[model samples]
Structures are given as structure tokens and as C-alpha cells.
Target: MSYIRGYDPETLRELVDARECKDRLDEIGEQRSLPALLERVWLLKVLGRLEDALVISEQSVRVARMAGTRKDLLRARILHASVEQQRGAFAVAEQELTTCAAEAEGKGWSGIAAFALQHRGKVFYDAGDYDAARADFKQALFLRQDSGVPDAQLESTLHAIEAADQRRMRASVAS
Candidate 1:
């Protein structure tokens, strides 16, 4: 039931078993610890439980605002924004990421700022704004590099930029 206790962060991200995460959530019952709630929100999102994920994300943000650190609140907002993005609420996701980016920048948390920018790029990508997405993705990659974040951490952003470039090229060709 508490199988999540055994999985390291890298393993949780790369090798999450949604069934196991779900089982753990069910067994953990009503006492949703912050970490557990965040993990469950992620797993629910991955499992296409969008409605459930959105509910948990909102709860996480609300709880984090009152009882968690700044970093925790930022992460909660990121999770909420990601779920909103998946739910086709691009504007909401963009707004959340914009707030996150500004907060992280003000706090000098370049890595988190980069992450928020990357997610904002994703919002643009979802909205078919390939040019804007590529711009944000490129800026995020630069910020991550400047922050000395690991290359692995920036890989997805690089890929997003590449995808946006390709899409833009195709659009130019078609027109």
C-alpha cells in the first residue's frame, strides 16, 4: 500500500506504475500528506483521470498556499497548471506558469523559472502558437543552461523547441 515509500524520485518520475500509485492512494485513505497528494495528482494525470487530477491539483494548491513553503506552493501551481493544460485550459495554464515564472525569477530560483517558462511554452504549443512556443522553449533552455541545471533536466525543453521549429517550418511551407 505504501509502495511509494520505496520509490526514489527518479524512479517515481521515470518508472511510475499508475496502478501502484492508485493503490497507495487508496490505502493511505483520507490523510493526504502533501507529498503523497502531489504524487497522486501526477499519477492521476498520467492515467488520464483528468477530472480527478484537476480536483486534487486544486486541493494541493489550496493546501500548499496555507501550510507549505514557497517552493511547495510553486510546485503545486505547476501541477495545477499542467492538469489545466491537459484539460484544454491553455489560458489558465499560461496564467499559472506566468505567475510561477515571475515568482521564481524574483526569488532567484533560475531553475524553477526555467521550468515555468518551459511549461508556458507547452501551453503555447497546445494552443498552436508554434512561434511563441519555440521562443519560450529557447529562452527556458538558455535559462536552464545559465543556471547550470543538468542536461537531462533540459532535454524535454530542447525537444519542445525542436518540435515547434519543425511545426513552424511545415506551416511556412504549406502557406
Candidate 2:
């Protein structure tokens, strides 16, 4: 029932199974705790339920604001920005991610900053800004390396960098 195995960035399908995601959603039904809401938002987003994800993400943000620490609120905001990115709100997502990354960096939260940078890179990639995406991914990789994150996490950023490079090359060739 755990979804961690289904989140592999290196996989062709990104390791997500829609049916499993839906089952997890059902299992988390009406659980309004912050962690539950966060998980629900992630499941809904993965299930391609963007509107529902956005709603749940917003509620999670509100909950974090009311009952969580600054780090928790930032994490919620980062997740919210990711949903916005997936929903094609590139500008909004980028702005929020920029702010979040800056705050996290200022606080010496390398892992959080790397996470924000990685997600921001995805926004850039989706928006066809491959240069920016690569830059963000590289920065995230550096931060993660400095923090001695697991190899799997490092591999994710490395894959992102390669993807951005490939896309940029393809775009230039087409141009």
C-alpha cells in the first residue's frame, strides 16, 4: 500500500500506477490531518485530478499555516506550487518556488532548498525553458550532494539535468 516505490523518477511511467493511486486516495478519505491532507493532495495530483489536488493542496496550506511550524508551511507551499505547476500555472508556480527556495536557503535548510529547486526545475521544463531548468537542477544536485543525500535522490537530479539538456538540444535543432 505504500506509494514510495511508485515514485521512481527514473522509470518510464515515473513509477505511478493510477489504480494504486486511487486506492490510496480512497484509503485516506476524509482524513483532514496535515499529513493525511498532504498525502491526499499528492495522490490526487498523481491521479491527474488537478482541480481536486489544488483544492486539497490549498486546504493543506491553510492547515499548515494554522498549526504547523514555518518549515511545515514552507513544505506545504512547495507542494501547492508543484500542483500549480502541473496545472499549467507556470508563472505562479515559479514565483512561489523562487520565494520558497530563497527562504529555505536563507534558513540553511539545504534539503528543503534543493526540493524547491528541483520542483522549480520541473516548472521550467514544462514551460520549455530548458536552460533555466538545467540550471535549477544542477543547483539542486549540488545542494543535495553537499547534504549527503542518498544516491537515489542524487540520481533524480542527475536525470533531470540530462533531460533538460536533451530537450534543449532538441529545441535548438528544431529551431
Best by lDDT: 2
lDDT of each: 0.80, 0.89
RMSD of each: 5.3, 2.3
Q: Could you tally the backbone clashes for each prediction?
A: 0, 0
| Residue lDDT tens for model 1, 1-175 | 2232222221112345767867766765665778878987877877678999999989999899999999999988988998899899999999999999999999998888888888888888878889998898898999899999866667766667778888889889999
Using all chains and alpha carbons, the TM-scores for the candidates as numbered come to 0.83, 0.92
Worst 10 residues of 2 by lDDT: 5-14
Q: Residue 48 of model 2: what lDDT?
A: 77
- Over 4 Å off, model 1: 1-31
Off by over 4 Å in 2: 1-13
In model 1, pairs of residues that clash are none
| Model 2 CA lDDT for position 5 | 53
